[model samples]
Target: MRQLTLDLQPAAPPSLENYVSGSNGEALTALAAWLAPDNREPLFFLWGESGAGKSHLLQACAATCSDARLDPQLASLPTSSGLWAVDHLEALADGGQVVLFNLINRLRASDGRLLLAARLPPRLLELREDLRTRLGSGLVYRLRSLSDEEKRAALAELARARGLELSPAVIDYLFARVPRDMRSLTQLLRAIDQFSLEHKRPISLPLLREVLQTSPPT
Candidate 1:
């Protein structure tokens, strides 16, 4: 018999320190406290639109704990210690809903913590009433997207982290030409960094245009 093997690429590890709080400082603070080892809350639900960094925060929380589980498929809840960080709660099937509902009940009786992320709030999710109510029982947060200025600041911070000194004019140039989102901006910044490294050149307007024109928009 032949054994089947599957190759999977590990996702980049996320950390609370790498996250740019922007306008969501309060939300960040609350999440940091909830993710702390000493948090008393048994459950937390975080809602945000696409690209609002819910996944990043969830993964970050999971990374902080040794026994944490992140993005586990909900056919049934696995018995695990420490925090359980579940993403895409809105897509849970009927069986998953029942399992989560029961898991929440079990966690309520123990020291384990739950962190859930979804595109919509529990009241609006297509889930069992009991499960939805349980999910909403603890602290609920709505993650806000960063503003344009905040995005620029985040890009500048990222550039600095990469040891690239970007001037105000260069920042403004990238902001005007690149997609006005953190994900896209960060990807573009990386591309620029790679291009500069390959060409042995400094990041300037000419190099920025060369990279932008040659590469597809992120």
Candidate 2:
């Protein structure tokens, strides 16, 4: 059989709406509800396990808001503010959370919006007093991990977007034969893309399995 080929150049990151649509169903719906206009200016906390798409949702919201071309001042900080996306709120240390709380408070008083993401829920965050209080009062959303079915669907979608013509049989084979998490799946896909370019071979079950066996531990 003739080998299928895919152009391997990178594309811009997928939008949050599209990324959520491709995520596990529950997360997509819950995020939509939390992001609606009726909820605007209400604090939104997105908590999830790693690889659960919180970053994607945050970036998407930022991108969508940026695209609206609202006054640059409004979208920016200090002189202006519209939307604020604080990624990895869990990484904040010392009095950082309290500072964040003040920022959010000011934005909200001015009728602006704030979106925050973290690996754990806000109440559990080891943060400063005012920050903890603010987080507790916010509308929290969880981005759940993908099921096996959702994982397969997501991988297939990624392959298509990358222009790789893969069969369900092949996708299923890799899903079972290798590490099945989204991160590993993406790593495997990129490796295959590189391998195809180097050896000029199409992505196949044999090629993927070989790559898996020989690849160093991440």
**Candidate 2 local lDDT, 1-218, one digit each (tens):** 32323234353464654563444566666666766767664677778887777777777775222211223222233435566667677666444554566777786677777777788887787777678788868778787777788888878888787888778888888877777766567667776777767878888878766665643344
Write down the TM-score for model 2. 0.67
Model 2 scores worst on lDDT over the 10 consecutive residues at 63-72
Off by over 4 Å in 2: 1-11, 20-26, 33-39, 63-79, 157-169, 176-203, 207-218
lDDT by residue for model 1 over 1-218, one digit each (tens)? 22111112223366788777787788889988887877789988889887788888888875322111232347435577577767888777676677677778888678888888889999998888888889888899998888888887888889999999889999999888767866567767777787789889999998887776643344
Model 1 bad stretches (over 4 Å) = 1-12, 63-73, 213-218
Candidate 1, run of 10 with poorest lDDT: 1-10
TM-score against native, each model: 0.80, 0.67
